[model samples]
Target: MEKVNYKGADLLAHRFEIRVIRHFNNAIEYNAVPFILTEIQKRSDDFFQFPLSNGLLGTTIVDSAVTVTINKNIAYEPRRYFTCAHELCHVLLDTEYIRSHPGIDTEDKNGLPSSKNSSRERRANHFAALVLLPDTILNALMMEKKSKSYIRHQQKVSYETLKYRISDFIQLRFLLSRSMALDIASAFADKDADPLQQKGIYGFWHAAEDENISPLSRQQIAQKNNDLALGLIDPMVFEGCK
Candidate 1:
């Protein structure tokens, strides 16, 4: 939650964003996650990792790859997605500036970067947020479906879902539904009903319970993402992060 040095982070974010844009040339409509990895591969093999531990929280490595374990036996989709993207930020944006830079403690059994001076891990996290929530796409989608119903809406969305995409994500599912939006509306319609589960939209929004903003959490992740670049972190990252 510290104030992020966005000005510096924006410089790096913009630089890399342009790199991705140039690589895509005119095909810039694809997902940024895969695209960033593609570009990283051209220069190195550090974006992807394997042998992830079952209870893994997070890790930042010298190369681009960061290994985070969600669950080996079951699927925890949201956390997995978040971790990979966070690690991606570390790989792409963190830079080493000699005297002014953080040093790697390779001899310390692989914590190369000492997590000080300039925190590469933090930078990567910022990059991950930008990649996952690219402004151009998220804003347009939210604005487009600003009036659609969440529950009644049944359609295949490439990046988001009718299930709990950002709309239901923030509890506006009723206003955005095509028909079945009332499935959960009645649950809350009683006026006595708890606002905990607004249809199936409950899970995603509370995916990170340690810190909740009801509606702003949706937008805050992106904003804090920029904040992390400035050396700040959303509570989730700061809460239990090493």
Candidate 2:
């Protein structure tokens, strides 16, 4: 991974995300995804539904109504949750900026700011990840049950499909890519376990053949997330995310 030093602004943005999560009481105490979404909406004065292009995920209009809208094109639950949370960040942190630029659509087509100067979008994405999957919550969940046991109870798929399913679960739960999730699984799974039976902990999934993590794979994961990624509040928020 390229070693891009995190500038002071980036660190401050990260700290801001941490504070936002705290303001919402960590968003995980309710132990329900729907509850988080409900809380977010309750904070808003009004919400709208709009059909947005595939590339564009959402928009927020902060006027007298404090309105927010997300693209209807995002069909999946995980992406929908992330997009909503992203806009909520704007509602919570960027209200002044939005109010000044009323009726202006922050056209973030790729989940980042439209321009290099738009640092708020970066911070919003970071805030969304924290709201959706706080490290503290995941760690506490893991402490209550063995990883393998949880997997076995949560799924009934054949051993052949379990590995991929686990990968999906990790990606959805932690807001990570498949490659990053696999790398995490490779580190968390027990090497001694049978390939088909291995299972991972909170932030990882069981590894299948050729899915093992090596130094090169680790670098790839970091690069995919951007070597200096800000999709997290705490640097150690998710193990193996770096």
Candidate number achieving the greatest TM-score relative to the actual structure? 2
lDDT tens digits by residue: candidate 1, 61-143: 44333322222322444334545554445444442222233232111112122344335444544455555444444334333
Candidate 1 accuracy as TM-score: 0.40
Task: For residue 71, give model 2's deviation from the true position in Å.
Answer: 1.0
What are the lDDT figures for the candidates, one per model? Answer: 0.37, 0.50
Question: How accurate locally is residue 160 in candidate 2, as Cα lDDT from 0 to 100?
Answer: 22
Clashing pairs in 2: none
Q: Which candidate number has the best lDDT? A: 2
Separate clash counts for every candidate: 15, 0
Q: Which window of ten consecutive residues has the lowest lDDT sum in model 2?
A: 201-210
Task: List the lowest-lDDT window of 10 residues for candidate 1.
Answer: 104-113
Question: Per-residue lDDT of 90-180 in model 2, one digit per residue for the tens?
Answer: 7766677778766434545556555343566666665565544444444443444344434333322122223433344456544467776
